[model samples]
Target: MPRHLLKLSDLAPAEARQIVLRASALKRQADSGYRPFVGKTLAMIFTKNSTRTRVSFEAGMARFGGHALFLAAGATQIGRDEPLRDTAQVLSRMCSAVMIRNDSQRDQEEFAAHSRVPVINGLSDLHHPCQLLADLQTWFEHRGDPRGKVAAWIGDGNNVCHSFIEAATLFGFTLRIAAPAGYQPDAAVMGAAGDAAQLADSPAAAARGADLIVTDTWTSMGQEAEQQKRLQAFAGYQVDAALMQLAKPDAIFLHCLPAHRGEEVAAEVIDGPQSLIYDEAENRLWAQMALLEFLFGIAA
Candidate 1:
């Protein structure tokens, strides 16, 4: 059976590590003038607007010598009366692969369940697998190894945070997430991460000696209406200079871009020294390109 990248943890530790290695090789090959997806077509399904995810996937397919067809939710019958399963069943036969960015994992899972082609989860409320690929790639590029390093997150344990926890557990890293009471990660994710954080007394204590410090917006896009409330709930959890200084001196700061100026993170810390965010953003394209090739089982 063909595999899909819906959640980072869905992959075994070995599989996740191989994706990072494969993604790196793909990056080097692309830089050296190799294009593999020539004449092929990729169907992209977007339920939300995006800057990085949109351009990265489109450019990735194109760089591999393929054409990416951008399909919007508004333009499809999905917005009117069509079922997601029906859409997936139909699209599977028309495109080589289907990449979807929507609000929920349930939607993507159902789509993949009904489709014969590979279903790439572009982004979901539960996980951002591709983004984490770029993130892990950047970590290796800058920090050398992910094993046993402390990577602390201080903010809402949203999609990105949860994915980081999963990655840390899978890769045997010390991941410390400091979120307010109501904004903690899911119980299952926390349990898995706890099983992996045995290197330290506890997860929070594990973050004290981290080599990387990461964070995200206090509230995501669709949660704008709850912005003020989130700010109040996430107080004292900002990744400001003081908090960032808690990590090792060489620690790198990462964010997925389109960051909030003062919420969750300070502007200087994100735009200043030790920030690997630009490379992180650039790696999104390369990492995703490699992921597609791997899922397709292209000749090594």
Candidate 2:
């Protein structure tokens, strides 16, 4: 049986910590020409569009001397309704591993269930463990271990927010999330976080005294149809300079990116000195490289 990362909860706390630590080390030696995955090949399947997820994984594999095969779901047999199990079995036989960015978590889980190779959830509707890994690595780089720290999430309680809830449980942090009534995170995810996660009455309440503040685009990829309604619902949820002022003086800001300047955040906040969005984006490559190494049992 092969280990698979279907969600953040799939990794034990210690394992998650190890991967983050290894990612930092890998970042330091990024140009050292260490190629543990010299002969390996990664099959990347994308059912949804991506920027960071695709480039980071592809570049990470190439950096490790491995090749990556990009398979657009629409262009593959899987688009024609070839069973996920069949695709999983065939890919597992040839690729060193598989990474999938899709709409359904259940589909990814089903595919992973049939895969002999390690299956990584690049992104899904329910969770985004890869982004969490890089986000944690960025936090660790700036502010040491996050255990006991406070993070504020202001916006739609979508996949990224859900992953943050899981990360709060695994990393022992408190996450304050502020979302509109119908847009809040899944009850099951929050329940799993126990006291680590909390619902805030407003963005101001969530950001108050927080060490890290984060938000995402009000309209996600699949939610284009709901843009106008979402804009109205999330009116007071933007993480602007005023909202950021409620946080600690030294608090940092993060967005998973392609940010909507005036919608989820202010241009000043995203491009300001307190923003770590660029570092967070760059860390995706290093963090994912470490993840690939961990999945393949390569030496640190």
Candidate 3:
């Protein structure tokens, strides 16, 4: 059976660790004669706009000698009456794998159910497993294993936060999330995290003694209309130098990019020496490359 990484929970603890390790080796290999995807093709479907998602997957495929076909929502019949199952079945026959960045979790589930090849959740309303994979790889590069470390998350408990919660459980880390009253993560996700995750009273509280500090934009792609409201609610949640001071002296900061310079994260913190945001962003390529190799059964 083909494996589908709809969420971090899809990979067992050992498997996730192996992927991280493989990502490091893949990065070292670079484009030095590795061509696992020669003659293979990956179909990429984008229901939402993208930057990193599109570039990383396209580049990764080309690096492996594979082709990536980009399909916009309206460009394909999926925007009209073509059933997702039909799209999945048809694509599965032609492509070696499928990756989708969508607005709904259910839609991704439906696509995976009908897909014959591996299906990767490029991004979704409920999870961004690809980003989490990159983040984990970054952590492993700087520090050793993050199994017993504490990671603090600040700002809106959005899709990225949901994946962090899942990662905490799968990677054996403690996740401390501090969000405003009404902006907490989903109850079911929090419930599933159990003792591995907790809500702190404030960003400072969560960052206290943490090994990693992470935050994302207060408003995501679809929440543009609520930008002002979200800005107000997340006003005091910025991951600035002051908050970083509360964490371990060696603790690193990370922000999934296209970040607002002065909003969710302050300029000083993200641009500081301890910030690993750029490295984290670059790891998306290596991590996804490892993922594709794993899904295609080319990696041990």
TM-score per candidate = 0.94, 0.99, 0.98
Q: 1 or 3, which is superior by TM-score?
A: 3
- How accurate locally is residue 182 in candidate 2, as Cα lDDT from 0 to 100? 97
Q: How accurate is candidate 2 locally (lDDT)?
A: 0.95
* Model 2 lDDT tens row, 210-279: 9999999999998999999999999989898999999999999999999989899999999999999999
The models' CA-based lDDT, in order, is: 0.82, 0.95, 0.93
Model 3: clashing residue pairs?
Answer: none
Candidate 3 Cα misplacement greater than 4 A, ranges: none
Question: Model 1 misses residue 116 by how many Å?
Answer: 0.9
Query: Quick one: best lDDT, which candidate?
Result: 2
Tens-digit lDDT track for model 1 on 35-79? 788866789999988999989999999888888999998998988
Better of 1 and 3 by lDDT: 3
Pairs clashing in candidate 1?
none
Model 3 alpha-carbon miss at residue 50, Å: 0.8
